[model samples]
Target: MVDFQERDTKRGLREDQEAAHEGPAAEGDGAADEGAPPPGDGEAEIDEVRQQLEERPESDGGQKAHPDESAADPGDDGDHDDHGHEDHGHDHHHHEHDLDELGAAVVTVSSSRTLADDPSGDHVVEALVDAGHDVVTRELIPDDYDDVQHTVDSLVRRSDVDVVVTTGGTGVTPDDRTPEAVRPLFEKELPGFGELFRRYSYGEIGTRVVGTRATAGIIDGVPVFCFPGSTDAVQLGVEEIVVEEAPHLAGLAQRDADEE
Candidate 1:
């Protein structure tokens, strides 16, 4: 009876050990079955995300998926390029109307000078001629206001004269009357001429440039520029300013004649 009891006790301990090992394995299996997703759940989620991306607008995230469809059309690119060229052309079209050669008149206004002694007028004529312009007529007149006005007025009315350049009587002295005499005849006053002249002259003459009354205007479709009497000043005005701008000014001033 004692031997039988010992065998039964040994079997009982062996069964208890097996139960402990199987208990943990069975709980692990239950966790996997209850907590894990279905077999096709991951694929279904991937499909749903792909469908949402496909349905998105091109302006949104869809552009990254299809690069060719998002590229600029070739015809649209050509139109943009053509529009840029047209804008560039329009900006420079006025250059075509500028004159290649023009007629000019030179006048010197001084109380103590003649054509033989007029260095400023000489410079004006030489510069204009050098720049391929014709000096239609040159005159030396006294500093009288009426003389200056009448001389410039008569010159501007001539069909052969496209521009008039005068030297002298453009100072602040008591006899200075070029601006006074010539301003009333102007149909349009070019204030920029005097402003730029003084600005450029300021480097050479300092504040003394303020005494200069150099001026310009449009009179009877002709551009008239009045410069100071000094040879240096006239040289600067002619070479630096007049020669550079006169052709364009002359062309635009005669636009009415061209239209007619």
Candidate 2:
């Protein structure tokens, strides 16, 4: 797969980032209970998320979403992505005119080493566009924990953005802390998301796919899905995961996110 910095440039975010939580999670829920990270949500939990959003150089006052400094490579074989999966189909199949009442965003994360022409990043943008949803913004941030957490909290708190599709940081490595970073902000973790993602990817790629740490959960009533750094992983994550389920999930999340 291409490096993380490379992916961020192509995979941008969706609009409506300004709307803060208007429904339940932000207002309905009582104080969040302290607990261990979700099932597969690993260690380095809180620290990694905070690290990513610290500061942006050159911009001085403009601390926009910072891209990763180093390029990202999953280290696993990238060849599997060459072939499309069997269960794959365009996610716009059942939506009402592609713009299904919800707004979305795409944020790619990595070290500062990303480049232009990122394949997976481009793929994410294309899929969201095809689905007819309004894509508002795109950003890059370092693989720091704080950055990831900030991004999640920022998007989720926004009332307009119904979902946030995040790529990278979903692994078990020392730096693979997507779950750890975002889990804390989640009022509830979507365990089935992790299981279903692994199952879907497994059928297509087989068991050699343990490196990914895919997950889904709610952050202040906003649905968030995190995927591995691979283009194939991102493909499956968005097409099979986000586009297909985002609408219903968004409504349910607003209503019963506590059960996510």
Candidate 3:
């Protein structure tokens, strides 16, 4: 009877020990599984990082910026380019108002100079022609106020004469009556012309430019410019001022006629 009891007790103890070992092993396996990552977890993390990089903006140097950082506004860039084009178009349109070619009448008010010996008159004609202007007629006359006035009046009245240029009698001498005679015929006096002439001439002739009466006026829709008698003075006046502004002035002077 005692042997039977001891054998049963030993079997019970062995079963308890096995139960304790099996329970701990099962609990350990469950903990390891909970701590480990799921299948494809590493690939999923890599895909998420790549997507974030793609969403970020890139700089001009091709470096990616922060997600919250922004580049310049595209609309503002477009506006700047459009504004530059607008300013360029405005300047181009303003230049379109100038006449391409015009007819000019050249007169030399010198008692001693004939058409053949008129160096100033020749320079005037050459400069006008070189600038693509047509010389309708050229004349030489004395420095008398009546003759100067009459010749300029007749030239300005001509339909072919868009501008009249006189190269003589603009000095402070006694016979320098071009400005006095021509001033009476002017409907609109361009003081700026004389001012600019003297300003530019001061560089070449020094303060002697004060003695110069280079003048311009508008008469009967024609621009009349009076220059000094010397070849140097005529060259400066025609090349520097008249050739550059004549087309624009002539076009403006005849704008009413053109519109009509």
Per-candidate RMSD, Å: 13.0, 45.7, 13.0
User: Which ranges of candidate 2 are over 4 A from the true structure?
Assistant: 1-99, 112-115, 255-260
Model 2 score (lDDT): 0.71
**Which structure is stronger by lDDT: 2 or 3?**
3
- For residues 1-260, what per-residue lDDT tens digits would candidate 2 score against the true structure? 22444433333221112122222234665654233123333324334544554532455465644665554577956566755565335543433333255677778888843537456667787888887777676666778899998988888777678888888888777887778898888887899988888988997789867777788888777788888878988888788878888877777667544445
TM-score, each model?
0.70, 0.58, 0.69
- For model 3, the stretches where C-alpha displacement exceeds 4 angstroms are 1-66, 69-82
The better candidate by lDDT, 1 or 2, is 1
Deviation in angstroms for 49 in model 2?
Answer: 99
Which pairs of residues clash in candidate 3, taking residues 3 or more apart in a chain or in different chains?
none
Model 1 over residues 67-114: C-alpha lDDT tens digits?
Answer: 556666666745444433456576578766778888899999999998
**Alpha carbon lDDT of residue 15, candidate 3?**
58
- The full ranking of all candidates by TM-score, starting with the best, is 1, 3, 2
lDDT of 3 at 161: 89
Cα shift from native, residue 127, model 3 (Å): 0.4
What is the RMSD of candidate 1? 13.0
